[model samples]
Target: MRALRCPVVELRQYTLHPGQRDVLIDLFDQEFVETQEAVGMTVLGQFRDLDDPDRFVWLRGFDDMPRRADALESFYGGPVWHAHRDRANATMIDSDDVLLLRPASARGGFPAPPGARQAPGEPAASPPSLLLATIWYGHGPFDTPFVEFFERRVRPVLTEAGGEPLAYLRSEHAPNTFPALPVRMNEEVFVWFARFADEGRIDDHLNRLRHSAHWSEEVLPAVSQRWARTPQRLRLAPTERSVLR
Candidate 1:
C-alpha cells in the first residue's frame, strides 16, 4: 500500500504503569491499527522508548483538521475501543502528552517504508534501525525564518553527520476538535524525526555534529536563542508491526 499523506499528525507519549508497556503494545498492535485506519486515520508508527521502559510512544496522522475530528469521533465511540478501552486505560498512568503538528514544508513528511509492515500474529523481531524524535520547545511558534534556517542549515548538518531525516514539523494551531482526548494547548514546538542504523550510528552522528565548528559556533547559538527550553530527545525502537522500521 502507498503511504498515506498526513498533513496533520499527533505525537502521543503515554506514561504507562510499570511492566504494562508490553501489554498495551500487544493490544494496540492487534486492535488499534486497522480500526483507526478504517476511520480515516493512519497509524504511522508505534514504538518503545529505549530510555524509559514505562513510556509508550506512537505517531498517527490525519488528512486535515476536519478529518481528524471525524476519525477520532468514530474510533473512540466505536465498538473496538469501547471493548478494549478499559484494558488500555488500565495500563496508562497518563496519556495527555500530545503534540499536534504539520509538516514544516511541502516535502517535509514521512515516506513509505522500504517494505510492508509485519503482519498481525507474526512473531515480533528486533528492528535493525533506531528512530530519534527530537522536540524543541519555543516561546512562540516557529515561523518561516526558523523553518528556513532548519532546512538550509540544520538539516544539511544532520544529513552530513549520518542521520536520515524523515520529517520536520512545527506546531499546528488548530483547535482541539475532540474534547474527550485533550492535547497540549498553547504550546509552541518544533519536532523532527530521524533514523540511524543503531545506537553506534547515533553516537557517531552526534560526535560528528559536535566536532563541526559550524554547528557549534553558528547553528547551535541561533537555535538556542529561539527556543525557550532544552530540547527533548527520544530514542525509540520500533514495535513489531511498525512500518517506519
Candidate 2:
C-alpha cells in the first residue's frame, strides 16, 4: 500500500514544567494518538528531546490547509481535548510558536512504517535516533538555487558520512486556522530530518562535514549568504510508541 501523503505538517516543540515532560508524553501517547487521527489528521510521530529533558517534540500532518482547519477544530473542540485540556496545559509552560511546514516536493517527506525505536535506558548505540535539523532562511519563499545547492552539494556529504535523509521541508504559507494554537508567523525556514546509527555517528558525520574542504569552503559560503540565523539542530529520540521510530 502507498504511504499517506501529509502535505501540511506542524513541527511542535513544547516547553514543559521541569518534571512534567514524561507525564505529558504518557498522556499524549495513551490518549491523543488515535483520537486525533480519527479527526482527519495524521499523528506522524512523538518524540523526547534527548538533549533537553524538559522539552517535548512531536509532528502531525494534514491533507491540506482546509483539511488542517477541519481536523484541528474537530479534535480540539471535541470532548477528548476538553476533558484533558487543563491537565495537558498544566504540564506545559509554553505551547505556541510552532513551525508550520509542508514537504518541499513529492519526494521530500517521511519514510514508511517499521521505524526503529531506542530501548529505554539502553546505550545510544543500541538503536539509532533521528536527527532533526531546522535550517532558517533569510525570509520569504526559498529560491531554486538554494534548494538545488543543498540537495546537489550538501546532501551527498551527509549521506556519505552516515546520515539517512528523511524529509526536506519549507515553511507553509497558509494562515493559522486554529487561533487557539498560534504558529510562528511569517517565518522563512527549511527543515530536514535524517537518521544516524547513534549520537556518536551524528557527531562523526558533522565533524567530517566541518573538516571537509567542500563543506567549509564551498557550502559554508552559500549557506552564509542566504541563512537568516544559525541553523538549529535538535537531536531527538523516538518515544516508545512513536511511529516515526
Q: Which candidate leads the pack in lDDT? A: 1
lDDT of 1 by residue, 127-176 (tens): 57889999999998799988998989988888888885788898998898
For model 1, the stretches where C-alpha displacement exceeds 4 angstroms are 1-4, 123-127
RMSD of each: 2.2, 3.4
Per-residue lDDT of 86-142 in model 2, one digit per residue for the tens? 999999999884899887766677766664433434443334466656566664566
Checking candidate 2 for backbone clashes, the offending pairs are: 115-245, 116-245
Error of 1 at 85 (Å): 0.6
Off by over 4 Å in 2: 1-4, 115-128
What's the C-alpha lDDT at position 224 in model 2? Answer: 73
Name the TM-score of candidate 2.
0.90
Give the per-residue Cα lDDT of candidate 2 at 227: 76
Error of 2 at 152 (Å): 1.8
Task: Judging by TM-score against the true structure, name the best candidate.
Answer: 1
